[model samples]
Target: MSVRCLLPLVIVAIVAVSGANFKRREFKIKIDGEVSFKATPPLSSGKTITWKFKDLQGGVIRVMDFDYDESATPQNPLFKNCASADKKTGELTLHNLTENHSGLYFFELNGKEQMEKFPLKVMRVVQKPEITNEKTTSNPDVVYLKCKYDKVVDKDAKISWSCSNDTTEELAYTKTGKTDLCCACTLKNDVSQETSDQICESDLFHEGSNIALTVVLILLFILLFVVIVLVLMYRFNNKFHDYVFKKYEKTTCLGGMLKNLDQCRSGKKTGVKQTDVTTVYTEVNKIEENNKEDDPLTDPQHDYEEPQSGDKQTDVENGTPLKKEDNTPTEHSDDL
Candidate 1:
């Protein structure tokens, strides 16, 4: 397993041996070495008290007894880990606790009722707080920070946050397992007053100082990627423009009427230049006017009305053509 993954097991083993190898500096070793208990009111002189130890795996055993009749028993040599008690005070002291001492211990006054219970748990000294930056912390105004430490015992440890602004904030820690507290906070954009730098620091422990660097690198990489894409798009923009213009210039597909008109003109005489189109239309109009003037039906002097069908039929039977008589209508014979 990786170092980070195996770290917890190693810390637990150290804590497993800490009760014997090293004692907590804050508490006296004598007091730390053993658990002491005494009955109230000096045990009332004549009354007695009994101390019992319940090893979770080994079963329950009576450690010692104090008698009001001046007969105070010594710690059972059988247990080897307990010491004698004061007969007058009815106090029981458990000494030189080892790994085997982890269990429950209780006291009984005069062997009648349970007076107090002691649950002994051995723990390793808490290491310095380990701090790490949260991964989702992308905001510049507020930075997310996390503090975690090994917890070997049930005792509560303090994790405090301090800044140069003369402010002390107690960080609330959440218990993850039997021996771990993971706490997080969103801090202001300003540098930590304690670290004397931009990063946060604690009196007991200081976390890795490179958290900010990693975040910066990630952001720079993302920005570089965006810039590259934009440059590529700009480089080929001319090709895209050419494609659109050429496709749109295909008049046959868009302006059908104009395309047909061009085809019709191309099929005509080659001598006729497209520039002479206006002149050709003017000449056609003059020819139409001359034809109209030559037309006999259009002559101003001709008083011509169309002949009746009957007249035209008779003329046809007689096989004689009708002549224009004076200022009247005319008929035509089939014989003519």
Candidate 2:
């Protein structure tokens, strides 16, 4: 083989060996948390270690360099006091992490580049969740609750609910019952988790106040309806009575009306049977006069006394005599 051909074969062999030594790892940590990466095929004596970072945008930066017996010195300001290295294991540790530190970390052994990579993801700690409640209008006994976190720092974070009855992974939960069942909410992520304060069912519903208001309104409506009915009935009764009396007056005579009214007052029936009859009256009167001849005066039957012009008299009606003016003696004979 030519020299150039031999050189290409050597280069290919070297690349293949280096690829076998490469490693990749992944880690997730919250802000202010600690994480460490161990070097593969642990370092030997006189071997130097170098750690570098690659950002999400493909920007590379050197983090630190150290030997087995010497302490690590960081080159980036971001990892000034936050980076450390173990001399024995050639391990790299980082603390006080932030979102800006999320990137790929690489390390070199004996000043030779190695493809060993550690993908780190820095996330914010989960905050305490907040819970809010709403009563269902269609059913007061049912309450709807929502678990919320105001400032969500991680897109992969999840919300869950825990109650006396059961646990749920939904952010919104429906609770039912009048018991003192309590519930709490939790916000969780790959790095950390937090829980909210517990809330009870009694705090969401006021059954007593709602029931009292409904009862009072119903009573008021019933009372108003009763009053209106009574007023209408009173007016109708008075009008009916007047109408009946006017009808009665149109059909009967005044005397008959008085008779019927009296019978009604006495609690007797006013019905009367019809009859037909005829009546006549005749009058005959006898008068006595003094006899002008002396011969008639001798008889006892013809004896009479003369009436004076100034004397009071009596009047007769139906065979009964009544004095006119003052007490006086008068006689009459009549036939009718």
lDDT of 2 by residue, 163-244 (tens): 6343444333445654477788877888888998988766666665688899999999999999777444433465643454
Q: Mind giving the per-residue lDDT tens digits that candidate 1 earns over 1-336?
A: 799999999999977676443333112222136666555546766677777877769698878776776755555564554576777677666677565666676777766766345566643333455455533324332334444444443134444454222222333222222222223322222111112112422312223235667888999999999977744443346564334434543565643432333334434536444444334546988999888777877767656677685564336668777764566545754446
lDDT of 2: 0.70
Which sections of candidate 1 miss by over 4 Å?
A: 1-34, 44-48, 55-58, 68-82, 95-104, 109-111, 114-124, 134-143, 151-160, 163-336
Per-model TM-score, in order, reads: 0.32, 0.51
Which pairs clash (backbone N, Cα, C closer than 3 Å) in model 1? 164-193
Clashes of each: 1, 0
